[model samples]
Target: MNEKTNRIGILPIGKVPEIVPQSIAAHISGCLDLPAIILPSLKNIAGCYNENRFQYDVGKTLQTLESIKFKDIDKIIGVSTVDLYIPIFAYVFGEAKQGGKAAVVSLYRLEKDTHGKKQPSSIVLERAAKVMLHELGHLYNLFHCADEHCLMHFSGGLQDLDASPLYFCRYCSKYFLDARSKS
Candidate 1:
């Protein structure tokens, strides 16, 4: 899809800070050249909490996100403050299905460093934007990059996430462009 046809929606899930989704929307327009709008906040994350892990399941959260309908939105990125995890991974900054219409990003881990130090507001915002865009890449069918500098690189923890850039590598950039074109 061309820039005109691809409109992204940022849906704040649960109790997310207002600025968080605003930042993601700004980054989507400034970095990706796509129109992005913040949708109304949804206070739902109820059925996704896992009793065993004490963390929200990414698959279930995403399933919940996919169930929501937003008119005129081609894709959606759900932002939340809760911790999210997949069955295989201990935690994830964000999660998405390949080429799917919806994705989710969690701010629980991004607020602190690997050493558990609280980060500055700027740092937290930057990390949040990076994860948002990275998951959006997956929504467009872009995979994890071998290049560590790319935003598409899998960030297993805070340290790795800090080291990765906020933009894609050259090859991944080309792939992202192609993916957007075909979407």
Candidate 2:
């Protein structure tokens, strides 16, 4: 485990679109200036699926990340197509353990509009990148930002997420850069 080497892992769970894992890895590597790789998919993540709720428990899914850990992997993000929820909320685009190196983002809520219309690939990709970075930001020790459009801001729904950019705000950007430098 060489702490000096920074490598992030992007893994798809369940029935996520093929592009999401690569999209997450590309965004992290290209935007964060860190090495990123896609790990093997976790197909059985749906085993934790709630039949009545029609949503997956994200907190439990996050625990599964521990089994996929490798010495060189500094962080891991799991991408999923299923709806995700925590006990505190009805649904979440993603969830992360504060200060932990693992996170998961759900594409289920990000794929459609309020009218239940499917979003274009461009829009879907953009949303995925934003949510991925937002969840990863939490793992990086960043809080929900005050700026509404910042990637690190909390998004309770697709409209909120769509309103946000794929980039962090100035303060968050500085924090991410500073932390990367120290690491």
Candidate 3:
């Protein structure tokens, strides 16, 4: 594989509106300075909930992925809501085939406000961007960072998500550049 030939394909799974995927893809491409292409959504990819109704369905996710043409892509990034399950991650890895390079950025709405109110913060947009960049970093083989302010930090909740910076730390930046070199 000539490193220069790597391409990142952004697929919008399920019934998400077209604009949503395009917006997310643009942000990721801007952050990484890479070309991002949005793939058509696959039918039969309806969102589902678990037995506990926790919101997840691996089977449908895998089926959707199998329907796509992944031949030309060196990496794939899926953009969807938190309703998506961990199995979606499994599907990505399974398709990526260990070192094949693929990842998914599942967007979750922040459940709180800065003042502790139940209201969603206007910062949710920023949070979404951070999540997109963070996952893209993983696709490039970057890991969690010790810098709590960096985008690569593990954000468990709304507070942690708001606390993390939108920009990557120095080490993460270097890793991103190295990945770009391979592409």
Please give the lDDT score at residue 112 for candidate 1. Answer: 85
**Number of the candidate with higher TM-score, 1 or 3:** 1
Looking at candidate 3, the ten consecutive residues that score lowest on lDDT are: 90-99
Best by lDDT: 1
- Per candidate, the number of residue pairs that clash is 2, 0, 0
lDDT of each: 0.90, 0.82, 0.61
Give the per-residue lDDT of model 3 (tens digit) for 22-135: 766677667766766787764434444565646556445544554566767766666665455555342221112223355555544443464556654345556666766777
Q: Model 2, range 34-62, lDDT digits (tens) per residue?
A: 78888877777856688888888888888
Error of 2 at 122 (Å): 1.2
Q: Between 2 and 3, whose TM-score is larger?
A: 2
Regions more than 4 Å wrong, model 2: 1-4
Among all candidates shown, the one with the greatest TM-score:
1
Query: Who is ahead in lDDT, 2 or 3?
Result: 2
Ordered from best to worst TM-score, the candidate numbers read 1, 2, 3
lDDT of 1 by residue, 23-95 (tens): 9999998888889999999888989999999999999888888898888888989999998999998888898
- TM-score (C-alpha, index-matched) for candidate 2: 0.92
